[model samples]
Target: MADIEFPSVEWFQALADITKEDPTYRKFGRLNAVIVFKCGDKHISTNFDVLNIHEIREVGENARRDADFVIEMEPDVWRGMLDDIKKNGHASLDWTLNTLDLRFDEPIHRNELQDGFKADMFFRYNPSLQAFFDNAAKIPTKFVAPVA
Candidate 1:
């Protein structure tokens, strides 16, 4: 297991590698879009197009992009989700990705597609995403400095 930090290139690469091998991920079809992960003052933007998952690019101090989703949360929350993945091979109640994002005090950005068609991708291909993160269960993770 790899000790990964949120907003780090290594973490995103790990997820990409895992997703590529997951059968469920292939079922999700091709997805092309970028997702920005922001925690406190640190920001990392990752691009996922087709089956390619790029490294996390530091975009500190830059304006946000027009992305499919913008996932923002406290550093501790991110660590908790990874910890949950490590324990259960999947995120549970308090650490479910969607649940965490929804519970965040700040706004979570998503495409304005009608009826949340864009957001539905998470549900439609949940098994794949779950499998992707489940790989984390096998890897060691290092906690980043938490925000208050």
Candidate 2:
């Protein structure tokens, strides 16, 4: 199979498909959080409702406001993380979202509504989230640099 473009609908859907088949995701418990991925011009929103990851879609204009918490980063950063997962079959400790959040400046700057609880959900659900991304190792990915 050809490598899916990073940040494309096909790419996110591929990961979502993996989450559906993997039972490990079930062990994480129920989750109800809207996760936003901001890679340059692209704004992708994924709803982790109840037991499964539902509705992985793209949005226009407002991603952060629409989502519970938005993870904004350059496309290169996303590519690196995904590539690491593909190589290692999971993210190395350094590439995990929590570690990346700490390493980057203004990683998750909240706008207007300051919900610490929502932000904390990322950590609370880290294992499942990590496993979700970890499944990316099964899929081949193509890197596309974000538009400057």
Candidate 3:
């Protein structure tokens, strides 16, 4: 298996690729939203069109202004959650996106950029989004070294 770096477009693409081929990812129905994931200063955005992830790219900090919403957290927190997913084949109860969003420790902040209408997509497609991330377990990933 090839090792892909986390928080990179390549890594996110791997996830999208895997999910595209899985019938399970299709059951949630079509999703139409632009979700930006932020780790510290890095911003990666993915556009979900119909039933597939159409694009994944690294965007500038200004991406949030265009996204329906942004999910922000420290890289360490992301790594921790990824590690947990890898170990369990999927996120455990505590590491699930909803669970992490609820926890005080390194909580995943959902910053709504638009009105409640657009921001509601995150919840409307929560199962699909969670399944998208769960596909990460299918890829072997390497964490980029943290800068001092």
Expressed as tens digits, the lDDT of each residue in 4-108 for candidate 2 is 888777888898988877898878778888888778888788898877777888887566677777777777778788889888999998899888878876654
Every model's TM-score: 0.74, 0.90, 0.91
Q: Which candidate achieves the best TM-score against the true structure?
A: 3
Residue lDDT tens for model 1, 25-143: 67767766666667777766777677666755767534344445556667777777887888888788777665665776743444433236655655654555556666777666776
Best by lDDT: 3
Deviation of model 1 at 76, angstroms = 1.1
Q: In what order do the candidates fall by TM-score, top score first? A: 3, 2, 1
Candidate 2: 10-residue stretch with minimal lDDT = 105-114
Q: After superposition, how far is residue 1 of candidate 1 from its true place, in Å?
A: 5.3
| Ten contiguous residues with the weakest lDDT in model 3 | 105-114
| lDDT for predicted candidate 2 compared with the true structure | 0.80
Better of 2 and 3 by lDDT: 3
Badly placed stretches (over 4 Å) of model 2 are: 108-112
Structural RMSD, model 3: 2.0
Spell out the clash pairs found in candidate 3.
Answer: none
